[model samples]
Target: MDPLSDILSVLKLRSYVSGGFDASGEWAVHFGSHEGIKFHAVVTGECWVAVDCEAPVKVKAGECFLLARGKPVRLASNMAAEPISLQFLLPPTHDGRIVTYNKGGEFLSIGGYFTLADGQADMLLNVLPPFIHIRNEPSRATIRWCVERMRQELCDPQPGDFVVAQQLATMVLVEALRLHLSARDRDEVGWLFALGDERMRAALSAMHASPGSPWTLQLMAKKAGMSRTTFATRFKEKVGLSPMEYMTRWRMILAADRLTNSTETLSEIGHSLGYNSEKSFGTAFKRVMNYPPRQYAKL
Candidate 1:
């Protein structure tokens, strides 16, 4: 019940590469705000990435960038170039190699997106920065490796190519978050920050590991080796939610995952998540997800 892994599992991350580009000279591509996150990698050459209200960042080969806030961004060979709409530049190709060759200084780059459809996705992702840049470093070998693997998987296909590519993309995300967490300031507050706290981590692990348990303030405080009042205050300060609220949130996410991916009955799902009855679980699910479990399962 790793907290980060649990969050990702509940979020149901779906990732795919839009296309690859081999361009040179002055070219700019605008990617509009999307429902999920976006990423770019410099495979062979260098490029500039500009997010709204932020200075342009130069990324070279072996480096990657992530946009978490669904903000519009522009990637270009030069800042002054008239940009081309990414939609036109990389038209949707259901099943093919999306490679484009252009004249000028050759620059090979890969771009992709990660989508999360879970009702609780925003709550989990709201803590992340709008943009995260991973530079080429000895410690970032795994990130570079994932990027290269994804590039090869896209450029060539074998058995289970989609699954393999998606897995590699997920690895990139995990590594990126790990790096960001390591570098984040101590004052920064979020899920990762909560995980960094010794007391909060223990309480969170307990909740995640045993979601079916009847978690209470006293129980969580004991788990954190603190008084009830101290634990409650610190938990809210770090996680931005009360203990029971976070528990309910996780329970709903777990229930949603079960509903969508399993054939288990409502009663079974509810019982597994500590709900007293199917009706109670359905009410909670509807409140959190805005739809009943039965209806959402069909969706």
Candidate 2:
């Protein structure tokens, strides 16, 4: 897999809920602080979205937004419409989980929340803005398709509608991240954006492809076709971590996954990640994960 896929694949999703909401007649709803990421697309009509106390942005049909972490969000037809807590406004789910408020029909949206495994989402979220607003554009037709299909899955229940909708939710998330990376400047710094950098990609790809390989600064620099000093400085600037530091973090994240899900012994897991001894691997794991392999397994 590519770097983005690698990171996203490692992120364990606990549960996901996919559905649509409909409202009409001077309606506003306050979505209290939520866990994981909440995403939505305006299927028809427009709404004012205020997130984390930031100024409200108008979202028209065909546009979408991703809200990360536990940010509180408010959506309304107009600010003049008093906002009610979502708890009060949300109608019980339909057969496929569509909900409604007020008269329900003038404004419509399709959305869902992903409950990622605790601490797992930051793997992807760290490189993203707290809130991402994707405007409707020729380049974002995928978003439109995904939203439309999601609406179908929710509006008409099927045997596997839940499974299909969850996958579509993940697809939207990836598209949003890809859009963000493409729009960023070359000088932008973040592991996700750095993956898109032409000059930095080779070196990062090498590390991802073979985490167990012996790697030195000169070697990594060579992969990037640069001198050690230049590559180190440039990589740090663009990726927000020295090459080796990034490698260790990546390796530890892999190890954490194995520790939680695999039956391998500490030494086996460590050796697979290039550590020669259990002690050395445990030391590195503690530094990165704050827990030894045995202890972390129970978590």
Candidate 3:
């Protein structure tokens, strides 16, 4: 599989279409800091999104913004509009249903939050910008489809609304990240850009496709078609980790998923990732996860 698909497949991304809002006249809403990644898509009208100390971003109809790190942001009809805390506005048992806020206004939007099941999401996804904005244009057909499907599903709930909406939200996130990555400079020194490089892409695909492989520095360099020193330097420069470091981390991440989702013995899991013994695998897992495999599996 491709690098982006490989990373996302193991991340176990799940999205929830939480209630949305429709506001008109003069109004503002503060969705304070949250843990899950949050997003808002402008379905109609326009509004300004203001994060602390930054200028407000004007979001017109058909535009969308994703708060990848769940940063605190305020949406307002105007810069000076007094805002109400979103925490106070929603009902106590706010089910995952669309709700209009300050009804009778022009700005209309659907919003939601998503979570990554993988505990190592920060390490794997930190290369992304804090916020990703995608304009509604022909070039962004995938994003447009996600936004439209999510809006349609949420507005008119069906028998399997939860599953359908969640899937749509997942697609939205993937498309958003793809667009974000494609917009960056080709020479950017990050894993996101590294995924686009032919040389680095070959190495990454090799590492991901076979985490259990007894990959040596020479073998990895050969895969990238570069000398050992050149490969090491470029790998570190682009991916921010030595090749083996990434491999070990990836193995641990895969091990964590297996431990959580499967009924495998510790030794079996260890050997699957090229560990000789349960003790060695446990040590590595603890170092990366700050917990033993047995303990983490229960969580």
Using lDDT, give the best candidate's number. 2
Global lDDT of each model?
0.83, 0.85, 0.82
The TM-score obtained by model 3 is 0.90
Among all windows of 10 consecutive residues in model 2, the one with the lowest summed lDDT is 87-96
Ranking by TM-score: 2, 3, 1
lDDT of 3 by residue, 117-219 (tens): 7576785447766677787777788777777788788778789988988888888887777777778766667677787678999999998888888999999
Tell me the lDDT of model 2 at 60. Answer: 95
Candidate 3 regions exceeding 4 Å error are 91-94, 185-188, 295-299
Candidate 2 global lDDT: 0.85
Clash list (residue pairs), candidate 1: none
Instruction: Encode model 1's per-residue lDDT on 116-161: one tens digit a residue.
Output: 8656678557988888999899999998888788778778878887
Write candidate 2's Cα lDDT for 159-270 as tens digits: 8988888888888888988897888777768888887877788899888999999889999999999999999998999999999999999999989888887889999999
Using all chains and alpha carbons, the TM-scores for the candidates as numbered come to 0.86, 0.94, 0.90
